[model samples]
Target: RGFVVFHAKFAENYRLYSRSHFVKGIELMILLIVYEIFGQPYRSPVAYILITVSMWFMVGTWLFAPFLFNPSGFEWQKIVDDWTDWNKWISNRGGIGVPPEKSWESWWEEEQEHLRYSG
Candidate 1:
């Protein structure tokens, strides 16, 4: 009776484990083996579809959906405010704007001098 119960318990655990992981693991292993066997010249349509689907899922769910999923995790409102301040500061500079190639330190000095002289 004790031996029978022990065997039954082991079998039950084995069955549960097999059900949870064995089928998926075996399928993945078989797929890898098949992929290795199939030379590059003969491509699998299913594999291409799977790869395309995965790429679409990743880009659509994460990259493009910024409001839903921010890749940088920056607040949208803060970003908008920063853009607004940058535009305001840039536009306020007189028609003769700072040259693009100048370093920030040099540009700042020139901007300060201009403001002081113009004021």
Candidate 2:
């Protein structure tokens, strides 16, 4: 029998060459700024929810969607348009607050709830 089974270096090189990188760190930075302004949950619940939803969609569209699914003959109109539309930064300036109970149980429960509804 002929041997032709081992090609680890070539395979790794090819895989690394084909990694998806549609969205870069700069785009995420812009989105982070947007989130800081309109998405701060402590400032306004509605605005926070809106920003969260928008950022979620942006992440899905730019980060995971392009690589995972390739729609037939599909193209994008603009790069990271989902997060770039916000023109104002209110800068309400709020810091992260500790959750009630100061323990991991409540956090786990919240994560479980999110997973249950998210899926």
Candidate 3:
């Protein structure tokens, strides 16, 4: 159960890490996976297990250290509200159709109007 909570928190922190460092995070995970898979065959089981566990612990540390240290003040509700307001402003001012409800014709017309006015 404790591992479960740790895993959940790790997952969230991993998500944050991925969002913040998209390409690098994906590359790191891929390389780690490749190393584990390919390197396992050459090494003794004990060595392999120890190394992989250590690697994952390091990955976990990388994920959670920033999470614990840097509470980036990410307010989800405020972000959503700001996005909604921006969407409304853009739609009202003719950027495109509103976010949730959209149509091809309306989108095309709005884009056309935008192009006409901007140029």
Candidate 4:
């Protein structure tokens, strides 16, 4: 279970970081091209400022994407609250506390049943 949780978190972080970095890399390439073409001689401060501002905006948007684009329309705070509640419930009565007599299949079925009625 610990291994699975670690891998799941790692995969999710990898996916998010890779996607954002790929986009930033493309943006950097475009900026480099622009700098080479027009700003090479002048080394315009305006161009530098634009690039900096745009990069910051991109970072901000990526950081806030989960909150901005949540399909469920829940606020970030509400989502955090719900996640903590679920974690507490699971720790107290679900996977972490499964009885020795219960097989994995039965434990899973019990979880599903709990979800069906609770949710």
Best by TM-score: 3
* Regions of candidate 4 where Cα sits further than 4 Å from its true position: 1-48, 72-77, 83-119
Task: Give the Cα RMSD of candidate 3.
Answer: 13.1
lDDT of each: 0.44, 0.41, 0.51, 0.51
| Winner of 1 and 2 under TM-score | 2
Model 2 agreement with the true structure over 60-80: per-residue lDDT tens digits: 555554434433213343223
Alpha carbon lDDT at 66, candidate 4: 40
TM-score per candidate, in order? 0.25, 0.28, 0.34, 0.29
Model 1, 77: alpha-carbon shift in Å?
Answer: 66
Worst lDDT run of 10 residues, candidate 2, spans 82-91
Candidate 3: lDDT of 44?
A: 83
lDDT of 1 by residue, 8-94 (tens): 222222233443444455555566556557747466867756655654454344322333332233556655654554454445443
Cα displacement (Å) at residue 92, model 4: 12
In candidate 2, position 111 carries an lDDT of 38
Across residues 10-115, which tens digit of lDDT does each residue of candidate 3 receive?
2233334544554454566677788878774878878866767866666666554654554432456544654565455445533343432232344446435666
The residue pairs that clash in candidate 2, if any, are: none
* Candidate 2 ranges beyond 4 A from true positions: 1-21, 37-42, 70-119
The number of clashing residue pairs in each candidate reads 0, 0, 0, 0
